[model samples]
Target: MAGQQVYLDHNATGPMHPEVVAAVLPYIQGGFGNPSAPYAIGQENHRAVDRAREQVAGLVGATAGDVVFTGGGTEANNLAISGAFLGRSEPMRRHLVLSAIEHPSVRETCAWLEAVHGAEVTVVGVGCDGRVRLDELAAALRPDTLLVTVMHANNETGVLQPVAEIGQLLRDRGVRFHVDGVQAAGRIPVDVAAIGCQSYSLSAHKFGGLKGTGALILRDPSGVMPILQGGHQERGWRAGTENVPGIVSMGAAADVARRDLSANMAHGLALRVIFDNLSARIPQCWRNGHAGLRLPNTTSLCCYHADAMSVVLALSSVGISVGTGSACASHSQEPSHVLLAMGLDEQAAFCTIRISTGPENTVEEARWAADQIAQAVERVRLVTAPEDIGGCGEDCPCFAHSSR
Candidate 1:
């Protein structure tokens, strides 16, 4: 915000909403009493927490009692996955199913369950369009499958999964379902009951709240076990002192998202349309994910012969920000697992960049950002593969490579 930069990386994190910041300041200043205590000061803080919980629950179509605030989306996802598995009474219900393109929190937690807890995990793959194969998921479900975890919207590509359909399938099979609704909650109208997930996870940060707060909305909380064994903070499902300021801000953010849902969605769709029209002029650029089944705010495109990291750095120098993939996977040198799972080869995966817009972004900014992105891609291609610069037509290797 300090420079001439145009940020198009809302999927990674977003700036706190102005109202959320205002609402959080008072809590940060003098509301120091513990929400768990019984004194008057403590009751004031407790009320604030309760009010925030209600706001968060309302955003996702759940009751306040069903929401358990966590440190972040990662913790919420972990709680949903491990807690659901731990709740199974029958020894026969020891297996779980997951999508191949789930966030690392869900993917890694499932892996841990398999390695340390002796649970069996089956990963259903996604198609080239980046949507999970419902047929494969249905086939993967077994008599012993205890839980099925799938993300409501993909973080990298912003592909929306058919959660409602999957939920009905799991319901018919009498298995527990968990949906990581972090990317879909604020941007879309999420009805957890309609989706029919036992536990649905949402991150405040992704929707203009503070980074340290998130929630797990449990349709029924009785079956789950506490992942943290400390003081019972989140109805004994999660432990430790509550982050009062973060939680308060998260609540305010949720309120803002609820109030502005329609306008924000329209704004995001407009920005995406602008970005697509502009970026199409760049050579060797094509979007990934399903055209209609993805988030209106997101666009993932591959610019052949140009490394994603290089394009990011080049754009950064010109005061524009974008993401190669999930910010959580930023440090890894490996290609994006989401792209790879969608059938992109190693080289194509390396060349993909994710651009996501927010409510504050404008058509003018989108145009400028698109120009900068095209320039960055051309610059990277010049350095990475200079021989491919002037080559044109179907016969040229560069042309053939770009067509993919």
Candidate 2:
């Protein structure tokens, strides 16, 4: 392994920005007063938290009063789905709509609702390009549908959904909409008003802030009920004492991300160009998402005949970090559900890996990482038996060639 590591898994988590770290250090060290207390020190912390709310709101084009801080993105998503459902009346809350490629947080929460609360779930499928089929989504909606939740960008394939259009459709139908913006918030321009979603969720760690902190932006705070009932924190939307330091860090990160959004996007595009050029040289290796309709920083590549796990391990041995899918489900031995929904078979899905870049990643690092990936895939393919080389069956060119 090399002494210097090249990180390409920004979708899972990004390194904290120096400014964010500096911003949070004071809160961690001496700004320890509880925001709920009546003392002067407590008032100061409360003011700081309020400022952070505005900063986070600015990143998503939302009002400060609409932002509700939570423990993390998972909790934010849980609050968005479960809280909205629980707040609704009987028949209205009976049905829910979701995309096929949502993060496990949204998927599992809906599953729980179906099992426990008897909510009917309609999971709309995606096209081969990993984009949700709008017609299918429209068809899935019913009078009993309470809410439709979809992610702005897929965590595994990075494909951007037709959120604005979906929002318009839901608006015309008088149905509520929620968007999981965890992977899209810092990477792209996000206007909640433009999206027309009633609620949106984002995580700090996916950008350049500390982990264990996130926020849910609500267009109408009264539309959803609180899952955690205790303090009057977050305007009665969420309970428990505030995470002052983490919230401060998120504010700092959001400010920087908004300021450098264009520059960061350009940097990501440059890295992707390098990766695409190099990876194109590898045999039977293809991108998994829409070529132009995905996040600038994310690349999902499938190297046929190379086991994704083996490739990931080989790249790790060389100090290049990547991921097979969402970090939340990394421990699962199952193939990527995102790819499968996009029409990839299990074997093709198992041979896929994700590379998501960040502002800190340089063009030189991207070149080195792409080269390492190609070499790693080659190494894995060399060891794979002919029988295991083709997942496309008898008509597959690779399968026919290997048989001879």
The TM-score values for the models, in the order shown, are 0.94, 0.94
Q: Candidate 2 lDDT, tens digit per residue, 268-363?
A: 999987776655789898888899999999999988888887789899988889998667656555678888899998788878889999999988
- Candidate 2 similarity to native, TM-score: 0.94
RMSD of 1: 6.1
| Cα error of candidate 1 at position 38, Å | 1.3
Report per-prediction Cα RMSD to one decimal: 6.1, 5.8
lDDT of all predictions, in order shown? 0.88, 0.89
Cα lDDT, model 2, residue 154: 94
Candidate 1 runs further than 4 Å off: 1-3, 386-404
For model 1, residues 160-241, the per-residue Cα lDDT tens digits are 9999999989887778999999999899999999999899999999999999899999886655787888798877877998
